[model samples]
Target: MRLYKYYRPDFYFEKSLRYDEIFFASNEQLNDPHDLVIKPYFGNNKEAWKSILKSNAPFDTWCLSKIVDIDNDNLTRELNDEFEGVVVDDSSSISSVLDNQSASLAQIFEKYLTPQCNAMFKKPEAASAACVQFLKEKLARGWDKRYYSCSFSKNPLEPQMWAHYGGGFRGCVLIYRGLSDGSINLRNNIYISDSQNFKFADVNYQDKDKLVDILDLNSRVNIIEQNLLNKSSFWSHEKEMRLLLSESFGSIRVSIASGMPKSTKTQIFHHAPDAIEGVIFGSNCSESYKEKITSMLAEKYSFLLPAGVPAFLTFDSRLTSQGKVEINYGAKCIIREVRSSQVIKEILENERLNTMLKELGIPQFN
Candidate 1:
């Protein structure tokens, strides 16, 4: 359950190490325009549509209840007139259904249905279309609700990740140890979710578009999966996972002009220093940035030392003679090197990592 975030050697990278924070971007700010977009399919699942109409669900609270508030008698008359000649197998429930009807259906129709789905309701002999309209509207409600997320990868040594996210080996990767429950510790200011408001899901890659069949039970049940967890196969190489924060929960808020659309943009979230395992500097990473990382880890070393956690070792990547990348603990860069606190104290004393540690006052390992 280790996660890695990639960053270029820039202000953001320095800020993250200094403040122990990460940023979550809204869908609008994400690299992929199509990300989090769902194309709903309203197919021939009559039974699914019927279940939605019959169940006392969220739809009943928002869609049906809103319709019912619009003048109950009018709703009853309109429903009866629309279905009058149509033959229903169970005529007994029809009266109850009529009594439950409310308000001018036209108002709710205009408020909910998109232009395409609205057209479906305008056709004659489209009683089933009405149900499809409502079901699609309910399923698509997630689109309007904003979600903020930061992405990570299961693989830390992926070359593509280095090239794409690491500014072509000039950047660095921050590795974190998961909590006891194997969850990432991401907090916004002082607000942290004990696993209730925040969520983590591995991204699922598919060759086709991320489609949600509105009439399918599985599709309707896993709405979050359909919208957030799914990604195009083109992204499979990254082995991505996401940490999601809901708009109602996270600390970041956006204020837009009255007529402009709302946006969350980028949000900063803090992580516990102890949660950080270490950092890996890309092959082409500059010495200046490395110094910055050293300074930050030096501060965190005191906190990590007391818990008997492994020393916060630095790693560097190299291209082997065989033309493949490898991590090694050669006199230069060590990979996952664990040493006793005394050994670490001695190592720092020797300044084995050049003058950077000595300059940063890292010898205070105690």
Candidate 2:
């Protein structure tokens, strides 16, 4: 899993300058990089984009940060870099699906069922009409075969990340944050179980060129707005939410996304979720910070917690002598089946037994 995390130059520089700053807590201005709104810098306006890029100087910086590398010496090496979404556009996940037939991602799995999928097919397939036509016929028959199980990310609030890139693209991007914890960085493993979060159109769009087209700004914005505006999608989302609680156990994800209403005359938006799964805090986090967040979640989002929603907290000096940390995402609950409470029980015992006895001043008894 060679995952690369993207960071704006300014965010990266700030992290470097203040190594222990807990940057996620700060109220400084932050943009949804993938769906940013920099005035005339909207859509594919090349001149405005160029100006924004020039202002950003080194542009965006991506780092080779793997869970394995988090504790290694190489993690400290700072990178200086451009194209906030260059790596994302060139992602092999996106390319492989189009190139590999086994993926079957070329087909629209469903129609008008999802406004996002409908708007995608409505686009002119310019450079790859053959692929588009094939998809249209395949989808017209109401193809229901699973086209993909992949990751996608966007402004969880405004999903325009791929609007200009031929629309109906989906995957969990490297960055995602709820309004509650929107400050977490690329180091976090942001995964999405698309089973309920998204529906890939059953159309196979093979022309990478067409998929990469810089669409009209208005068109791109409209596609995103349509996704939000799809009242049917929200109904489906509500059903999925109820079904998730009824059918799932162990780990899950709960996301609060910004949705558009069904009316074209009004622009009011509301918050909803795509669900949540196993989540762990970054090792750089402070204990007090952890407590504050846990308290907030318990108070405001208690309904989201399942039988055992796990929390992975970084250790304070009181826990160990050397501060060595082992990120336990291998049991991420997504990749492998997490069957029991053994892992959680073990963690609690390791973190509490000795402290309990010492604090109570109990005699060592066999």
Candidate 3:
């Protein structure tokens, strides 16, 4: 199981220091005998296990091999000259490349690696835990009353519940409990629904305080769950209003709903008295219906003392062939009415409009 190793003689320098006099003959000089041994573990002899005693003899002699190459002055001079030229060339090349490489490395480190490393080192989990504990402690002392109190349950269908009572407060909070094995169970049990129902048994009022503390702890857990879903984005008022209205009252179908109300028919004239540019109402009606509508328009227009006031309106009975009406008021007025139920359905289904109304501070009638 032992791995291969490449140990340079330099590694033994420190250990050999104590035996400098015997090994090197002088402290200032490093003229010690050099020995290089290559142990092959792959041949027929290598496959056979050798006794420690048999290997010890060669090992000892290998450690003290004479440094004949070092003592050769001519060979040493040639080697020195070659090495000196190589060293100078390497030094120049390295120096030239160092500035460019260092700058590139610094940019990469700052742009990519540093932020990741810093974030990795941050104690986020510990910080979150600490925050939860602090909130619990504060709540126990009755320091923060603005928060809702809730309780936790062990049921898979009901893990956490929050309770709130009137004074504009009354709802249950619930959370799914995440299991250690990466599975989750929706334990919808009330964490806290009503504060009044909770009991504090201690005579010193401390028992009641503990209930508050528990509520705070549950709130923290719920917050963590919310963070996972939303990432701290601001809530869209329009979206929330749409959900609230649509869930309760249902969508308004537009394709089938009748055209503008009869009241709107008359009001259009009053709003734009001069808008008499070929306006028509009703479809496949008798001449009597057309005459009645014409008369009504004439009477309404009689008050228009000024003529040619940009009156632009058009209508076509042919438009109703598709179960819908198309009324065109040139550049000023446009009105349409449909006979199918889908017209109303579209209006009802338009949650965005509903939400926009709510965001505009409109009060819900139902």
Q: In candidate 3, residue 228 scores what lDDT?
A: 19
Best by TM-score: 1
**Alpha-carbon lDDT, every model:** 0.54, 0.23, 0.21
Worst 10 residues of 3 by lDDT: 241-250
Instruction: Name the candidate, 2 or 3, with the larger lDDT value.
Output: 2
Predicted candidate 1 versus true structure: per-residue lDDT over 1-366, tens digit per residue: 567788888887888876778788866778777676555544555455445444443433234433322233433344334433332112122222222342333443334333344343454224233543443343333323455677888776777788889888898877777655556655667355442234457888876655555446655546745467777788887888888765531111111111113454447877776667667788788778776676566654544555545456566665455544444321222223322212232232133553533332222121
Q: Give the alpha carbon lDDT tens digit for every residue of 204-290 in model 3.
A: 111110111112222544432222122111221111100000011101111011111111111000012232233323233345533
lDDT of 2 by residue, 187-215 (tens): 11114222223221111212122222121
Error of 1 at 301 (Å): 3.7
* Candidate 1 off by > 4 Å: 46-144, 190-199, 217-219, 248-266, 303-310, 321-323, 330-366
Looking at model 1, report the run of 10 residues with the lowest lDDT sum: 250-259
TM-score of each: 0.61, 0.21, 0.15
